[model samples]
Target: MPARLPYAYKYLRAKKKFPHVWCPGCGIGIVMGSIIRAIDSLGWDLDDILMVSGIGCTSRMPVYVDFNTLHTTHGRALAFGTGAKMANPKLKVLAVMGDGDSMAIGGNHIIHASRRNMDITAIIVNNNNYGMTGGQFSPTTPQGAKTSTTPYGMIEPDFDICKLTEAAGANFVARGDVYHVIELDGMIKKALSGSGFRVVEALAPCPTNFGRANRQGDAVNMMELLKDNTINIAQASKLSKEKTEGKTVRGIFVDRDEIGYLERYEELCDRVLSEVKK
Candidate 1:
């Protein structure tokens, strides 16, 4: 008889609703696996977790996983997730989006969600360019990067997803790359275990679209780039500014204790009831 697979496969082992639509070597699949393993390690009931996604390459994640899922319009995953969390605070809500889906069209929704500090965990896969609609430059695409839309090289600066969310007041914010799978898993698990709005900006490679346009070679080459280019927060503190220049920082940037939206809403409802009683 064949040996049994690890416990985490319990999630993947059960439901394969469809063949994943992601391209070979696309890191979105790795991100999805990290999510599943993290959730499994946490032992959260699948029924109580609500996975939501917007239109994009990464947004197709919910199609394969066995969880309560909602596939919404482009730039609206957070909007729908916020409503679900408000309606049923007991449910664990997770919003998955690609860099383009969240940072471009859904920009306002993410900012408001972070400011609202509601109970939601956002997993944003930043593969530089838009993978689904075309290899177009996105808000997170690096300056001077080549893409289908920016043949002359992108001119504008890119938005740092973690920093943006932190400034917007998310309770927890972290940056992780698909190359660091264990670290990514830990970050996602920590984000899931927290309250208020949390965001995990996952830097993944889009070898199919983004990579092809930029001539980043295959998925292995992109993974090597991640390994060399990113440094963790702990090690970064010891390095000089010049040494770390042009390198990406990965790890938890913010973790704070703050009241979530549901508690405030409940308090208002109680106040209204007490006023009527009087």
Candidate 2:
């Protein structure tokens, strides 16, 4: 028999749930493993960790993980996670959202959450299209990429998720690819270690829908494309935009100290209470 999972049984649901819903050659599994490994490395108490997700392929993550999970409404994972964090500042809130879930319908929540500097770690799995919803062209779908909804080709520009989060005021923001598991894991660990709103955009491949439609060959080919088309942010800085066109830049874009929402709220409450007593 194949060796068992590296994680303890407590970290997963019943074995019956094994053989996840993701299709063959899906990179979401690799992203999931990186997440589990990041949490394990942190040595956090499972009970204190709350995994939240919105509707999409990546959203299905919380269902399999054995932590305190909340599978919420579509494009609202961050909104719910924000409330959860504010209610119990002790909880480690981790939100897993797909590109469509995070950037499209949920875009407003993401920006506001970052602006408030909420203490939540968000992992956005960008497969370039809406993998779960008929492989539709999402907000992050590259310009001129063909999808089920864009048979001719998409005409809109794609949003750089890392840049969006950083500009929105997230204290920590980074990008990683499923093809680079080690680097992905390290970035997740770093995001988890930081306070205030943080985001890690993980580029995953949806071979069945996105790959086939885009003529990207099979899953292996898709992975290779991800590896070859991406450049580290450090190296990208030295090159002109023309030279970096069509390249997905990956690396920590922003990391700095900021006052988290909960901290600020608590201070305000204390001040108000003292003044009332006086």
lDDT of each: 0.92, 0.92
lDDT of 2 by residue, 26-81 (tens): 88888889889999999999899999999999999988988999999999999999
Query: Stretches of candidate 1 above 4 Å error?
Result: 1-3, 13-16
- Summing lDDT over every window of 10 consecutive residues in candidate 1, give the lowest-scoring window: 8-17
Error of 1 at 229 (Å): 0.4
Candidate 1 lDDT for residue 144: 92
Pairs of colliding residues, candidate 1:
none
lDDT of 1 by residue, 1-278 (tens): 45986765566525546567888999998999899989998999988999999999999988777789999999999999999988888899999999999999999999999999988999999999989877899998899999988999999999999999999999999999999999999999999998989999999999988888888889999999999999999999999999999899999999998987788789999999999999
Report the alpha-carbon TM-score of model 2 versus the true structure. 0.95
Evaluated at residue 77, the lDDT of candidate 1 is: 98
lDDT of 2 at 234: 86
Give me the displacement of residue 60 in model 2, in angstroms: 0.4
